[model samples]
Target: METIIVENIYKYYPAATKKERNKALNGISFTVKNGEIFGLIGPDGAGKTSLFHILTTLLLADGGRATVDGFDVVKDYKQIRKRVGYMPGRFSLYQDLTVEENLQFFATAFETTVEKNLDLIHEIYIQLEPFKKRRAGKLSGGMKQKLALCCALIHKPSVLFLDEPTTGVDPVSRKEFWQMLKSLQLQGITTIVSTPYMDEANLCDRIGLLQNGSLLGIDTPENLTRNFGKPLFALKAEQMYPLLLHMRAYDQTATCYGFGDYHHITFIDPHIQQADIRSYLQGVGFTEPVEIRQIAPGIEDCFMDLLNH
Candidate 1:
């Protein structure tokens, strides 16, 4: 079953001079299935946050319509709020309140108690229990994130929306948090998470790649990477910086970008031989043992390919 449906959603922010409005979201559309973890993957200012606010009914879209669990975002906002849980990009809990107090408050707001929904958040709650008396503002970054997540889930919501949940947290905490989400999925709760990290795209059941308030593509990570229909190679030399410039200047290079330790390149002519590239690099003053080999496209590669086209 489709748990959430967004159709041609559009949102705009007025500028001071009124010459041009900031198009936060432009005709964006996608659907989330029940019991699935759907991801909106993009960099900052890509309209991921704006789209989240619209679906959560915190902000209204100027055009188009969205329904969460069959309740329209505008007409049935009250019903949607009751059924869905939202964790904004910012930590929004009462900072002065203790960890336990914050959780209790959110539970009360939902007309429920912590104990009533304890089973729903046991894995996460146990981590926060030791710091139950600690003021939310005094907790560490990872702790604050866990506490926020606990509060959002205290209501046993059927659908959950998490916006940039791991943006500033430590890597270990990010891994743990995603594990918690995976556990939540087993309970049949649909989740929608927006993230700027390209690596996290593979964690979701499916992802929508958004850029400049537009969706570039939507599909499973494996399929999206597979669709990047070009022979890709990774090259590296003793002088990494100089190799990048040389690769870009090459006649056969289609796309060349620095990726970690290696410079990833795609050939404009697929029939070009690797031996030819080696010879070219050697002629360009690169010594022997210059590394160049075929490599598969990753999620970032696919995203860049989409952006380039």
Candidate 2:
């Protein structure tokens, strides 16, 4: 079952000058399956939040159509709102309200009570129980995240939309949050989450790589990496920036981008060996102990590859 369907959705915003419009979403189309975790992976300004607002019926698209839980995003927004849970990119919960008060507020807004959906949020709520009396603004980043999630799930929504749920969260909290998502899948709740962190792509069942308001590709994380057909290598030297420039200027270099301690490069000619790269750098007066090795492409690598093309 397709829990959510988005077809040729378009959204535009006014630019600095009144004569021009910025395209926030450009013909975005995809289907999220029932009980599937679909991730929108990209950097900021990729229109993740814009798309989220459209699906959650908080913002209307300029063109195209979308349906959440079989309700049209524009026309049947009221029905959609009742069946779907949405956690915006920012913390939108009442700051002055205590954690318990915030949860109850959302539940009441949805015409439901926390007690009725206690089982849905039990795993997450327990973590926030000790701080239940604390004001939302006074809690830690992780605690605020938990409280927001609990409130979102208070109504036992059929589909959950989380926009950048793990951004600014601690490493441990990010791990714990993903675990909670996986647990939600067991209960047959569909999730659509967006994040700028490429590493989080692996946590989803399938991911759509979005960039500059367009989707580059959609596939399972494993398949996306497996399909990176070019020969890729990681090169490291004492002088990082200089090495990156040299690699980009190489005749056979298809793509070169810095990846933390090393610069990842893909060869235009697959036959080019790792030894060839080392030799070229050395020939260019790069006397530093250069290290070059063929390495498997990751989600970030795939995303960069897509961006390059």
Candidate 3:
């Protein structure tokens, strides 16, 4: 079953004096299968949040249509809200309220007490229970994150939509959070997550790469990297900064993007061998220069290549 189906969805924000609205989603269309972890991978201002708002029934798209769990997002918003659990990209829980208060409020709003959904959120809720008396605003980034999620799950939703849920979370919390998600999936709840982190893309069953309100491609992490169809090499030297400048000078350097610890390069000319580049680096007295070898492309590499293509 398709848990979410969006077709040619277009959302625009019109300037008050202008004749046309700025487009947020450019006729985007995709379907997420039931019981699968689907991802909307993109950077900030990439229309990811806009699309999430549309599907979660918070905003209206100027054109096009979307349905969640067989209910039209526009026409069946009431039902959709009831069946879906949404955690917005930004922290939106009651700031002044204690952790327990926030959870109690949402539980009462849904007319289902926390005890009613205890089985649904036990694993995550227990972690938050320790800080139940703490003000939501006073909690750490990750604890607040867990509380927000617990509230969302109190209703035992059929589908979960999390927008950048781990954005400011600590590494330990992020790992713990993903584990909670995996546990939720075991209960048959479909999960849709949106993130700007390329590393997180691999955790999903499939990911749609979005940029500037456009989806560049959709595939599993391994498949996306495997089909990159370009040779990539990693180069390192004592004078790393200067080495990149020299490498870029070569006409054969198709793409050269820094990857923190090292820089990745792509060859436009197949005839330019790795050994030739190695010898050139040596001639510049680049020390042992470590090593340069053909390397497998990762999610980030594929994303960059897709943008260029």
Per-prediction tally of clashes? 0, 0, 0
Best by lDDT: 1
Model 2: per-residue Cα lDDT over 153-179, one tens digit each: 999999999999999877888999999
| Candidate 3 global TM-score | 0.94
TM-score to native of every candidate shown: 0.98, 0.96, 0.94
Order of the predicted models by lDDT, top scorer first: 1, 2, 3
Better of 1 and 2 by lDDT: 1
How well is each residue in 120-221 modelled by candidate 3, as lDDT tens digits?
Answer: 989988888888899999998888888889988989898899999999677787888889989998999999999888888988999999987788998888
Using TM-score as the measure, which candidate wins?
A: 1
Question: Residue 44 of model 1: what lDDT?
Answer: 93
Model 1, residue 230: distance off in Å is 0.7
Q: How far is candidate 3 from the true structure (C-alpha RMSD, Å)?
A: 1.9
Candidate 3: what lDDT? 0.88
- Per-residue lDDT tens digits for candidate 1, residues 1-309, read 899999999999986677899999999989999999999999998999999999989999999999999999999999999999999999999999999999999999999999999999999989889999999999999999999888999998999999999997777888999999999999999999999888889999999999989999999999999999889999978788989998899998999999999999999898778899999888888775787789999999999999998
How displaced is residue 94 in candidate 2, in Å? 0.8
* Candidate 1 runs further than 4 Å off: none
Residue 49, model 1: lDDT of 92
